[model samples]
Target: MSRTAWRWSRRPSAPSSPRSRPFRSKPGTWRRCSGANAVMSCRSPAGRRRHRPPEEATMQPEPITCRLIVEAVAEFYGLSIVDLLSHRRPQRVTRARQVAMWAAKRLTTRSLTDIGRFVGGRDHATVSHAVRVVDELRERDADFRQQTDDVVLAVEATARTLARFHANGPEDVDPVAVARRILATPRGVPIVSIPEITALASAVSAQELTDSSKMMTGPMKRFRSEPRDRESEFDLYRAVAEVLEADRALKQAQWTHGERGAQARLDRGLKALRETFERETEHVD
Candidate 1:
């Protein structure tokens, strides 16, 4: 037979229809035809439909509140909450207060009026003025700009701490036990310390932080049963959370720099916690 005739004989079968053609897939995988059309349907080795698993849920950072911004600023500036809320016109106090207002406006979703109320009960115009002043200072004053950045960092860190607490906090959190644990935490043996950490610790204290935490955590049951004023409750919660945040900052400082730095941080933090407690008490009353 001729080579052409031999080749022709080798092609014995016609092409199959699309629906009847063999389906190709990678090794260890196969496609099943569900109907007459032979549409490819993916399946696992167990013969179950393969499905893409759902994306894991992510925990979002909580919104930074105006009060938290103010608290953080006051803590950074070494001023009390009263100093920010007062009508005092000292350059130190005024500058701290304005920066706080600016931070509140930048970090929170509050209106200018609301920001003013959170800071010191001023009107929207005051908040606008503060924001403008801060902008101008940040442009012209390197030192002031650095200070603002530090305050912003502090506020954000504090907010993240609170967010984590809210997201993964224990449902059966015991205020008294937590407070006792906080109180029992040792200052650790004195050692090398960072000045900044020392300053923060000196400004705030473990006692104040524990007290604030207790106050906030203690009333959870009451909150569900009683018809308390929402505004007061909110203020109290913020105040308590700020204190707790301050404590955490001190602990981190301690971990990094040992006892001395932690003490300084605790001192600074205690001062701020005290101011918050006093302010929240006034609001509640």
Candidate 2:
């Protein structure tokens, strides 16, 4: 009979050769040891030694984005991206939509409500229902489950491809140039409506509530508590400023470069956002 000597030490575990390694714990906190002993964690619950490759244990694939997942799922199920996002409910379109919801929920950090917004403007409850329906169908029908799996697999592949492309894409791309191009676009970019808000707050006299008001002159109007309070809310001021700047640029582009519809929709969306906010200003409690 031959006997083998195994030396175990407090170091990062590896499939080959015992060597010094940095533990994932606090710096210089690992115990130093040397002997023909094995790490207890090296053994599985079944009493078998388990070894995993470094990549398998520590390397995680980049997160797949919601957009890529939606595109891939739609393509895999033979549905157009429009059909996937549309309010239509043909059986085939519905299945693809459900699978898309499932994939977005599984692969992205976006909330159910966000998933709903992307997938046909449904609510979080609708997204939850779609996910549940897909789960039950996967459990009850093998073919349906396989189809869902295929979509998921396809999405994963698409994400990896996109990750690779982005990783290798231009590192020196100029953000200024990008901004110029977008601002110069005749139709402009897609618009996201600003939050509809009423008066942010009403001016109220604090004198009624506190003696401090007596020391102060005038109504002690409830001015903003903090000058920087707007920091927490959407930067409507900055956005409006940007739109104004963009509008000026667009007008120049139209005048000099013969651009048309440069600020048509963009101007309308900004105006609506401002009007809504002005009308919905918050009131004193």
Report the lDDT of model 1 for residue 38.
31
**TM-scores, each model vs. reference:** 0.40, 0.40
In the range 1-285, model 1's lDDT, one tens digit per residue, is 999999999986998999998987766443332331232333344545564322213546667776667667777877655456656566998899899888888877878877775555578999899899999999999998999999999888776676766753112122333334545766744332343232233223323434444654554455445555788667656655655565555545543656566556556655665565455455333
Model 2 earns a TM-score of 0.40
Note the residue pairs that clash in candidate 2. Answer: 198-280, 198-281, 198-282, 199-280, 199-281, 199-282
* Candidate 2: segments with Cα more than 4 A from true spot: 1-60, 167-285
Clashes of 1: 20
Model 1, residue 70: C-alpha shift (Å): 1.2
